[model samples]
Target: MANPSLKACFDRKKFVVAPGIFDMISAKVADGMGFDCLYVTGFGTVASGLGLPDAGIATYTDMISRIGRFAQMSRTPVIADADTGYGGLLNVRHTVMGYEAAGVSGIQLEDQEVPKKCGHTPGRRVIPAEEMVLKIKVAAEARRDPNFLIVARTDARTGLGLEEAIRRGRMYGEAGADIVFIESPESEAEMVAIGKAITDKPLLANNVEGGRTPILSKARLEEIGYGIAIYPAVGFLAAAAALERAYSHLKTAGDSNGLPASESYGFGRICELMGFPEVWDFERRWAQPAAKE
Candidate 1:
């Protein structure tokens, strides 16, 4: 049976803390970690693999194929970031259907215009409320599964003010979005205000490291009425820092003699983690008798 929580991911029924899984290795690691859900973060996926910023550079084809891979390989349910639904109404429909078919439990579609900037960064602007409302409606209608979620986000808090952002959140909830995400609330007070104002549906909090929002504990986020918090930058940030340190050491030392073995994954362990044991077993089972010498 499909995971019940995929359908039950509304009304703040359960709080979820989803770590961002950017690639197959991260996905495999997190899939085994007992997390109830995982987030396919756009920023990490673009930056970690493509060495590019998350600035609308990746197309839907670029993203959805990877999103499908994440979904296929992960044991945990996936909530993917679908920036601006790729385009207008028809695009919204296509994005929604595609994400659901690709096997994500939910998709977050933001209200920012195309060539959309990251939510925490500057110079972000939103579409008209009516326009995004239509997008939300189309997304909600596009999914074949009634349980599949439309996570409606408004980047109005960045360039626009918090009040406008909250208003848009409310508007989105009324438009049939399963969850309301008011992106980049800078202060706890603003977060409280969002919780207070948008009472009809569950709320989502974007917990980006070194980004605009304050990082709150799961208890505090639940206290503030957030049903889900996605830490989209955590995997990539830690991975990037580790990579820089390891590379810097190797360049300075001329060899890897000083780099700690503990710092990097053991090759054998990695092969085991990535299912090489299964391959080995298949090879053994299929092997022919050694030739006479």
Candidate 2:
């Protein structure tokens, strides 16, 4: 099946559920689960992969490289995060091209300042709307393909309020953004408010599990007019917590055999997800023949 791009998804009107992926394994699983897209989220990558928060510590190169890996490994197209475009408007142009070259179908650029903080975190600041609009313009211009989506994200829900956030969303749409992501809404009312305010524009919403906001179901999100809902922490959070528990049990028992048997995964199940049979087939086909034949 052909992978779905952000552009194609907007018109579908159904909320696109993109589970966040930090590694090739998660990418493979997301693809296997028939997810419409893969979201290479900055927060999930930093916390799950680097053991850090999404505090602008990771570089653009690092993010793109990780995104490239997922895009290569999975059939799902990636929706990548390009935080603050790594700098100014010119920097946004470069960052846009960079992520495109990395094979992302869509890229989200936030309005947070350099050394950006987490959108859900306290003390978050934002750049002027004009500055962000210029960045969005550069991003829209830099995209080589019209199918490549440029998502404008504002951290304004915390800094300015829902009104300004919706205003920014409209301004971003006017400035050439393909979709607007109003990050980190704290309640169902705010979620409905943002969606209602940006009526004509394609809207993106974050569904980070265990984060500061309430989690809404897909049907509810679609009713609220959200085009995409990214679960950036779902897979990463589950994996981290499970692994931590397994490790604790092993350390205390000195053996995994004593751990809960129901929690185990079979080798074949993992191998299939990793495409082990295909690899073995390819290996056998290409292996050099021994002495006689």
Leading candidate by lDDT = 1
Q: What do the candidate models score in CA lDDT, each in turn?
A: 0.87, 0.83
**Native-referenced Cα lDDT, model 2:** 0.83
Clashing pairs in 2: none
Q: Across residues 1-293, which tens digit of lDDT does each residue of candidate 2 receive?
A: 12345567677665688898877778888878887788987887777668888899988776778877777777777888889999887889888888887778888899998899877788889999999999898888888888788889999888788889889999999999888899888899999998888888878878876676788888888898888888888887888778898999999989887777656566788998888999999999999878884
Which has the greatest TM-score? 1
The per-residue C-alpha lDDT of model 1 at residue 293 equals: 95
